[model samples]
Target chain A: MITLNIIGSGNVAQHLISVFQQTENVVLQQIFARKREAVSHLVADAEIVTNFNDLKPANVTIISVTDGAIAEVSNALPYENQLVVHTSGSMGFETLSNKNRKGVFYPLQTFSKAKAVNFKEIPICLETEKEEDFALLERLAQSISDKVFKIGAAQRQSLHVAAVFSCNFVNHLYQLGHEICEEHNVPFDILFPLIDETADKIKTLSPKEAQTGPAIRHDQKTIEKHLAFLDDENKKAIYRLLTQSIQKNNG
Target chain B: MITLNIIGSGNVAQHLISVFQQTENVVLQQIFARKREAVSHLVADAEIVTNFNDLKPANVTIISVTDGAIAEVSNALPYENQLVVHTSGSMGFETLSNKNRKGVFYPLQTFSKAKAVNFKEIPICLETEKEEDFALLERLAQSISDKVFKIGAAQRQSLHVAAVFSCNFVNHLYQLGHEICEEHNVPFDILFPLIDETADKIKTLSPKEAQTGPAIRHDQKTIEKHLAFLDDENKKAIYRLLTQSIQKNNG
Candidate 1:
């Protein structure tokens, strides 16, 4: 059985704790939080520790903390030459202190406190500095997820940027759409099926091939009509910019 | 039974034909395509017609042609004062010739010929010039879809613009993400779970509340790093613009 100790009390940390607890082949050694009470409800009181010095030695230590705090927290780990990793998509694997065998166990999914996520489908991007540590990291990642990608720090960084475009920026576009619907006094639910279908189309067809609309067709009349309808300057600018990008990319 | 006739042989027309054939309360009277061969495979040869004069009388004659062709098609339909509707999101209800009772039956989902879509969940936006025609249109819409909205021409036009932002623009962002993953030699599947989660989150939370990532946090460091990682000038510009937009929207 792979023994794991998770550090931090954020959404990612809590999710990891819950998944690891239920995983048959894994033993959750302990959970570390700045305040033990933060994670006390997730595990036994004995398994919660406030001080880094009190962290138990385990087969793997996952530091699922904030991106900025990853370095500081990894550096503060009392033990050295142990398998230590952080769950960050943007941060480089080297950000973890050299005292421990550095690795990355980034689960590429958004975690919300209210949502119960099934870890089995989440893709865990794993990286390790040492070749020997690769097996352990892969094994640990496979224990929870069906997909485990052996990506380097550089690739992971690029993947994070791609994610920002696909997830964060796309969600922003949805926000803009939501605002437009609200202005017209139309229920936002009308857009949900379209949103879902747009996402689903890419699974079988490449996004470029799946693309459709006035922009790709270069229907200038409709484009002008849409632009005239938008009252918000920022949204108008965004619509124009993206419409141009789509035309250029597809044309 | 509600009798229906479909015009055009495009993705929307074909999908509507398939769904109407399966609907218990609906009787698909005929399908009109300039080239009968294009849609003959979908319905009985007797139900396919090349000339508008051959179109049979029906409760509704849906002109599911291109937005540009709606006026001409409806004007060409030999029948007058019949319920003739166009399946376009952006086109105003008046686009249909005044010779016929104008209405709109826009299905608000992306339809691809290669993909078999389940119409039950797709939202059908219905609009009509005559208030009395609403019940008939609603009955036709309800025969195929579970969600039907009575949207006015103005609201439907705005909703179309909103759909451009959410569906067309959002799909372009996915294209960008796919390019990024390709450059990094990372399998795009890694982002699938994240994409699904991001889409799922907005179902329960407002897009404003569901937003995450460096821009939401105002983490300038990671944002700059991501911008630098994007080598393409257009992509760089998009990254910068969207980052600013997110910051402004959330700030």
Candidate 2:
């Protein structure tokens, strides 16, 4: 059995630990968190540690921490010979350099602590410096998921950038729509079907092929009318900018 | 088996035909289209009628024509006392006035012939002038989907407005992201996970709770940096608007 150790107790760590515990070959040897009280549930099952010195000897040490703390945590870890991995889409694998073996086990899915992750379905993105060691991470990933991808650091960075544009920014747009409905005494539930369908289409069609709206058709009349409906100055600004951007892409 | 007569051969009609066939009780009886070529598919399996006089006596008559022609098509229908319904989210049930029995069988979903709809999941909004007719319509809707709502014409209109903001507007944002990626020579495939995850989050988390980005953090520096990346006059305007909008919400 391959001994797996997880460091951190945030959303990613919790999700990762849950998946690791499920697998037959992969055993979660230990889990670490500074605030043990914060992760009381995790401490009960696994050999939980707050000190880096208390980390058990394991084949793999996966660090699931915030983006800013990645470098510091990589340096602070006691393990020198173990296969060290960080579950970050944005940060490079070299961020944990001088470590015997380093890699990335990024799951390209947005996770909330309260939400249970379906690791078997979510795509596991794997990357490593050494070609020979890639298979270990890849095999470990495939055990939990069928949608594992052998992505490089550069492609991963591009993925991160694209994610910000689509997930983070696109979500902000959903909030705007919700705000618009609330202001107009309209229930946001009306938009639920439309939003669900839009996402559903992308499974079969590309985002480019699935695109539709006034901006796509260059329907300036409707666009002008919609722009007039905006009461907030910033809302109007966003409406104008997005409208213009869509029109530019129309041709 | 309940006989279903469709009075249009547009996207909604085609989709309804495909779905109704899978359903246990409903049977697609006849399809009416203005053009013979348009009704070719319906003619293969079911009765096809071009003239209103050729309409068959069925349990239900669903008019799925363009919004502008809903009244005209309903007027031309040769039903004496059958359940007459138009599948429109915006148009009121009264559009089929003069007819003794009328209702709106508005499926709260965007229908494209290419996309297959899971009728059981999408909410079908129904409304009628007569209480009995409304109940019948609601029951019929329940046969197709559990997510049925007895929405008034005004509420339907409001829902359509929200749909525009959520579906149509959100799609425009996807295109904007695609354009930005294309301009940067980055493959748009990278954004798929993010887009999928963003939509999936709402299934569990509310838009307000699921929201995350530079805008929410009030990270003006990153927002300004991202804006600089998009040198287009209009793109800059959109960034500023969304940033301000998010900051306002967070505050």
Candidate 3:
């Protein structure tokens, strides 16, 4: 069985706390938050620690704070030479204080306070400074998730950027779609199935092979009609740029 | 029973034929293809008509040809004053020849030859010249899908553009994401769960509310790191533009 201590009470920390509490082979030893009230609803008061010195040794200590605060919190840890990790996609494990055995336990999924996620489906990306510590990290990751990958720091950075494109930029497009529908008095829910299918198609086919639209078809007439229909300059610019990109990629 | 004749053997037409064949209250009368070999595998020789003049009378003749050919195919129908509709998202019902009663039967989802989609989840946007014809169109749509909307011509145009943003543009972002992973030797499948969750989150939360990442957080450090990491000028430009757009929208 693996015992873990999670720092911070943000979205990622809260989510990991909830999942690890229910995981069969894992024991959440303590939750360290700046404010005890920040995590009072998630765990018993006895399990909450507001001081770094109060933290007990666990198999792993996860710093789930914001990226900017990761280094500071890792530096503030009172103990040394024990397993310490951070749940960050953009930052590498080297950012963690070298006083402790450095590692990364980043889960490659978005966590929102408004919705609870199933940990089993989330892919855990792991990295370790000492090769011997890799086994414990993998076991910890696999206890709650079926997918565990030993990704290096460089590849993780690229994956993070790729995620920003797929998740952040894609959601922005949905917002544009919603705005268009709202302006025309059409329901935005009408596009939900299309959005769902677009995501589902990539599971079986490559995005290049699954691409379908006027942009890929090079139907200039339809493209022109669509361009003239949009009044927003931002939306129009995006439409033109993305259309050219798609055509160029296909060409 | 609502009898329908489908013209063309494209992705849309073939998918419609497959679903309508299994529909209890609908009868697919005839399928017209320029090349008899195009639709020979889908229907029997007796049901395939190469000549439009040989098209017999049906309750509705669906001209599912290319957007440029809809008018010509509808004009070529031997019989006049029969209910005729074009399956187009961009074009209105007026695109069909005035010789026949006009209507639009547009499915607001991406149809691909590589993947088969569930018709029940697809939202069918219907529009007709005569108010009475709407009932028949709705019945035909309801026979397959549960989601139906009587969108006007202008509204349907906007919906089409919205679809382009939500489905087509969104899929392009996925392609870009896949390219980033491939360049870094990271298996692209690692992002599948994240993609699925991103799509699923918006079902309950608005896209604006569900947005997460460095762009939304206004993390200049991470953004700069990402921009510096990308070697491609196209991707770098996209990252800057989208990041700016997200910030502007949130601001």
Best by lDDT: 3
lDDT of 2 at B101: 77
Q: Is the docking of candidate 2 incorrect, acceptable, medium or high quality?
A: acceptable
lDDT (0 to 1) per candidate: 0.89, 0.74, 0.91
lDDT of 1 by residue, B183-203 (tens): 888888789888988888899
Worst 10 residues of 3 chain B by lDDT: B37-46
- List, for all models, the DockQ compared with the true complex: 0.80, 0.37, 0.87
The RMSD (Cα, Å) of candidate 2 is 4.6
Tens digit of per-residue lDDT, candidate 3, span A30-92:
889999887888884238889999988888899999899999999988888889999999898
lDDT of 3 by residue, B1-251 (tens): 99889998988988888788888788899889999887787774238889988899889888888888898899899888889999889998878899889999999889887699999999999999999999998999999999988998999999999999999999999999999999999999999999999999999999999889999889999999999999999889888989989999987
Best by DockQ: 3
Candidate 1's docking class is high
Each model's Cα RMSD: 2.0, 4.6, 1.6
lDDT order, best first, reads 3, 1, 2
Worst 10 residues of 1 chain A by lDDT: A37-46
